[model samples]
Target: MSRYPLRSTLFFLCPLFSGLLACFIWAATLPPAAAQERGGGQTPSLGFAPRPKESAPDKELRFLRDSTAAAAISADELLEDRERKRVIGRGFADLRFLGKRVQADHIEVQTETRDAVATGNIIFQAGNDRIVGSRIDFNLDSERLVIYDAKGYLGATYYITGNVVRRISVDRYEVIDGTFTTCEGDKPDWAFHSRKSTFQIEGYAHLQAPLLSLRGVPAAALPYAIFPIKSKRETGFLIPTIGYANRNGLEFSPRFFWAINKWSDATFGVDYYEKRGSRYLGEYRYILSKDTAGQFNTTYFKDKLEKTTLWDIKSSHISSLPGGWGFSAVTDFASRKNDDRSLERNLNDRVRQDTDTRLELTPNLKGIPGSLRVAMRRREGLRENDGDLFQKFPHITLDVSQSQIGSSEFRYSLGSSATSFYRVQNKKTTVLQRFDAAPSVSLPVQTVPWLGVTANFGLRYTYWTDQKRTPDVPGNPSRDDQKQSPLSREIWFSSLGVAGPRFSRVYNGGFGPFRDFKHILSFQTTYSYAPAMDSRDRKLIIPIDNVDAFNDQNTVSYGIVNRVLTKLKTGEGFETRQLFTASLTQSADIAEARREQNLSANPRRPFGDVVLDIQSRPISLIRFTHEAIYDPYEHEIDEQTTGLLLEGGRNWYLGLDRTWRRKRSRGRDPQSGRSDLNFSAGYGLTRRWFLEYLTRINNVQNITLQQS
Candidate 1:
């Protein structure tokens, strides 16, 4: 000690030895630089020794350097917020602390006039995304922080070390210019690079001039783009259609829809064809309540080529109408004028048949105007021959049955129609005002044993006028010679009785020789009377026109025909009594039957006929018809017709008919002709094939296939 220069020797030599020992101990016992500040402390410097920026070799810095060795910050202040906590290290302004406990090895810190920088190797964080980069920087006063070329980790996952930075109280940024992506870290096929980007502290980002490359090709390029921070709904346009059709040529349809209220909406679109022009359509729908809704849709087209117009309108209201009344209306109109007159030749003569208006109201209306029946209807038909005729018009009807007057067993209906008809040939126009009211009277008189007598009365009246036609023969007595009359009257009466068999018999066998078979016999009789008188010169014909025969008593004309049956058991089946079994028929010549004129001179008198039918198995059917003439005094056979038909299923079928006229001749080659025979037969060859033969010996031809 005496030889070395006392003060210098003690300062330099002793402190140097002490610093060496301290360095050795720190390197051995303390945690790594990253571990030293792992929890909360001043981070140890690595890349560069902790040092304040030189200040012009100023007095204060020099004084501080002389007064104390650099103020050493402890590891605790390294991880704490320097600005908010207002905590500072005074003993050491620039600090370095190497640690032995944590995993990382490198740590760094630098201080400048306005900021402080800290950087190090960030270790693998078990649950967080891993990043690897070069460096990180932080501004103390501004509380801005940045990481540069810093590599971070979570387990084995590591990202490219470019930037993973957060500037306190400022913003965050992940520089991806040199970034590589790998869903499988071994061999990545895609990469991303961006010139610059801004990211919110909350984690959303806006990138600039970003390029996404896949398999070495530029997948996407965006000058600027924004990404949503959360999931949300989006609005956009739809794709248009492109297609072609033969008649319509090239076609295109563009459609769009808008969602408006929760209960209502609309859609509109257009259909365009290069050849046929374009059409537009729109639909609107609304829900008035939970149970009721209304919808309307319409379409229209105006052809540029032909100047034709077409449109359809439809409106419907569902069960939601008031009082459970639903309404529907459809109106469609179309008119097409041929683009070229020659085109009409290719199509059928096009006559438009369209309904001008169609309205349907249902279920006893409450929502509709008046009642369920409060409606007006109109329609027209167009035909080449008819030109234009009002087939139906605006006819209105109301429910008048609230004053329900008819019996429950019967119904009373009253209706009227105003209509017009145009004749094609004569070109005559006729207008009609028609009224009808039918109240049917039915009285069922049950007279046991005697019969069930029923009386029914029907009344029908018509008032009309005709533009009378002048007869070709001026003096002819035919109806054509009569002039039109304004008024007329007709009165009719009908009465009938229904009777049952009082006595019945069954014969087990024959009528004569080979005619033996099972037979059933029953007898019944029905009587009817009808009289009609009218001053209407033109007598109205009914289903049956009554002719006089056995008159004075109820003629078998208006009601049921009277008959007694005697069924005979025969080999071919039971043979019916041909005499009594005939059709109950009346004459069409009302005036002639009324006079009942018969005699060689007046032999063309009206006649009444009756026919009977019988059928028995393979022998088929047999019919016998007899006509009785009325000469206003006597009844005799005027005409008789017999017909028979036989069939054996798929094997064969045969039919024969004969007719005989009964007009007296008086040597004039007989006023009436003899019987004419007609026959037909069919025989099946197989299940689905057949042969047929037919003949009308005295008349026409007829033939057919049976099993085809």
Candidate 2:
């Protein structure tokens, strides 16, 4: 019964499934044959079947095939043999493997070994290297190549040609009977030929038996030469500089650089002058740390004509340490024998040779209240003209903080110094040692925003050890007492009070090109009084330091300052600028009335000269400045100077200056003046050309004194 049931079920389902299969076959065959051909017919079945395990030889062969097949090979005609695993391509054959490409007229490749040979106009390219040869043999898997009768371009900036070329790696090559040049075309402007040469990419080239040629003509020969192929710092001989000057005749300077380490380098050079003697120069640079660096240079020459040896040395160093300590030193020293005749023609060199050398070290301490610093310095000078220099060997100074006084509004400061001033001239030395201490306290009171006042009191004390030299008298017999050493001390006190009121206003209306305008007016009157010292105390005091005895003064100085500021809108942002400023100052001596002046019993004049200063920039391109000192009592201007500057587009500029000095002698005319005028202008004639002119005129003499 079970068998019969199963048979029945199959009998019913079999016919239905047969009918569906027949329908599918009919539908598949319904497309036209032409359509099937155009679509390349049905795709072959990719069966889901496991492959046999590969043997070692099979795996090796597969690896070689894969390496060779990584790139594509194409040709107009191709012949392949599967049995031998070889391919032969002709008629414009090309191959590309990895990043290397090769094109040839005829090519042969062995897939199993990944080897290739090409002949007849072969061109190969890899990275920046391009090679053209008659024949090439290459191994794809090893990336080794050998070329015969090859010429190539290296980095597109250099050319190399050789009878035989061998590539060792991507960045290294060896050539036999090769020529190298930076020029183009059949005949280059300059070239080097060598018997054997080796090139390292982005590094350098080494040549054996190199001969330099210019325009196909041999110029120089070297036993062996090493040249830089990359623009990097390396230890090498630099290109010699050749020049000719009227004073030096033909000059040749050759330099050699030594790359001592990553942070230091030195260059040594020799300059040969055909007319003059040779000069030796050396420069050294070092970077000790991020914030510490230094340079030292020296130049020495022996002049045959002058029969003297001259040398100049310059060195500078700057260092910053932790805890706000800093140090700097600059030294410029030159030979003293040729002060009148300098070996260098540059004015700046001559000035440096005559200048002094200075070294300084400073340590600072900072806090919320203020900062304090201590400095030590040394100075030395060279040349006869610098003989009067006040040499300070290890002068020390201390500046204390300006701290608040006991939590009050007053602030106090202290400054002290000990210095030794010495002068050496004509084999004679004079020295003066001094110690100075000054302490000051100030209270700044601001009753309102517009009004402010400050009261200050200070005391200065100084002690000096002095050396004096008296002048020789023609008819006196005190020559033996010309030298004396005196010790002295002085102390003084000073008090000062300053008060001022400041006013400012802003206007919102647009005026011409200005978007807004403001006016600031400040007026200040200062009255100072100090009583004269006693005659007895003044006689015992000698002024050896910068401090002087107190002088009797009772004076009032008044000043008015006016400023006009304008705001303009710019493409980037709003800009505020001061358009104009004017100031006037005058003083009156209050105690002058107590002095008797003339035979008519008139009191002395109390008013001093009036000073006016004005600076204005009415337009963006023009500016004017004027300053004058006027004696109101004499009705004359003592000194006056006015300057005007105009700047325009594209290097166009003009400047005019005039200065006038009036004679102060009583017999001279009050209005008589000596005037000088200077004019300078610069204009662009073209984008690359410009014209500049400068001239000075003596107006009183009606003559042009200088023009350039």
Query: What are the per-residue Cα lDDT tens digits for candidate 2 across 1-708?
Result: 000000001112223221111100000111122211221222221111112344112222232123323544656677776799877777667666656877788878887777889998888778767788899999765667999999877654457899999998887889899997655556655577999998877666787877766557776676665654542356665545555555557777777888788888888889998888899999999999998999999989988766778888889999998887888888877776655343454547646534557787776656534333344433345555545344666577767666788879998978777777665444445556767777888788898888877776676666666423332322111224223455444444444545457889998888766877899999877767656555444443333344534445678888999999988667786688889999999999887856665727764788999999999986779999999999988787899999999998655899999999998678877677799999989874322234576677899989986554
Per lDDT, the best of the predicted structures is: 2
lDDT of candidate 1 vs native? 0.40
> How good is model 2 by TM-score?
0.53
TM-score of candidate 1 versus the correct structure, residues matched by position: 0.31
Q: Per-residue lDDT of 1-708 in model 1, one digit per residue for the tens?
A: 000010111112122221111100000111223332344333442122234455222333222123232322333323333455322332112332221011132333333343444334533221233333344454423434556654332122222334454433332445544443322222234444566555443234455665655445665554544432111111112233444544456766665654566677666778887887788978787887877777787878777766676665656665445766666555543342223221111224233343355565556644333333333443433333323333323333443232223454432333322222222122434333322222334455666664555555544343334322432322212344334444233333344545443333444544443242333233333344435443233332110111111122234433233433455557677565522422233433444556654555776444444333433232234333334332333444555566666767545777777666654757754344555666667764322223465444442222221111
Single out the weakest 10-residue window by summed lDDT for candidate 1: 1-10
Candidate 1 Cα errors over 4 Å, as ranges: 1-433, 465-494, 498-502, 508-638, 660-668, 671-675, 699-708
